[model samples]
Target: MPQLEPFYFVHLLVWGFINLLIIIYLNTKYILPRILYIYLSRILISKL
Candidate 1:
């Protein structure tokens, strides 16, 4: 069984959401693009 604390609940939840958004943003804008580029380049080089 766990005890629930009340104060700062909204703050914690909001921070979690913000962190999730940052991770999603970074993966979509940065990581995914780089991965796609690298994979495409490798395939192109192999073809050439």
Candidate 2:
């Protein structure tokens, strides 16, 4: 198929890597911390 072209493969790989990096960065920078904070707060409240 036309999608099997080498240039298209490289383009797809580059964009995929960039998108993965952004997702990981955002998860660590924002999502993970918020989740951890909520979990810890629940534990603390339950212990009280």
Candidate 2 per-residue lDDT over residues 4-37, each given as its tens digit? 7988889999999999999999999999999999
Per-model clash counts, in order, read 0, 0
**TM-score to true structure, per model:** 0.73, 0.88
Worst 10 residues of 1 by lDDT: 1-10
Q: What is the lDDT of residue 20 in candidate 1?
A: 100
What C-alpha lDDT values do all the predictions have?
A: 0.90, 0.97
> Lowest-lDDT window of 10 residues in candidate 2?
1-10
- What is the per-residue lDDT of model 1 for residues 1-48, given as tens digits with 9 covering 90 to 100? 234554468779989999999999999999999999999999999999
Pairs of residues clashing in candidate 1: none
TM-score of 1: 0.73
TM-score: which candidate is best? 2
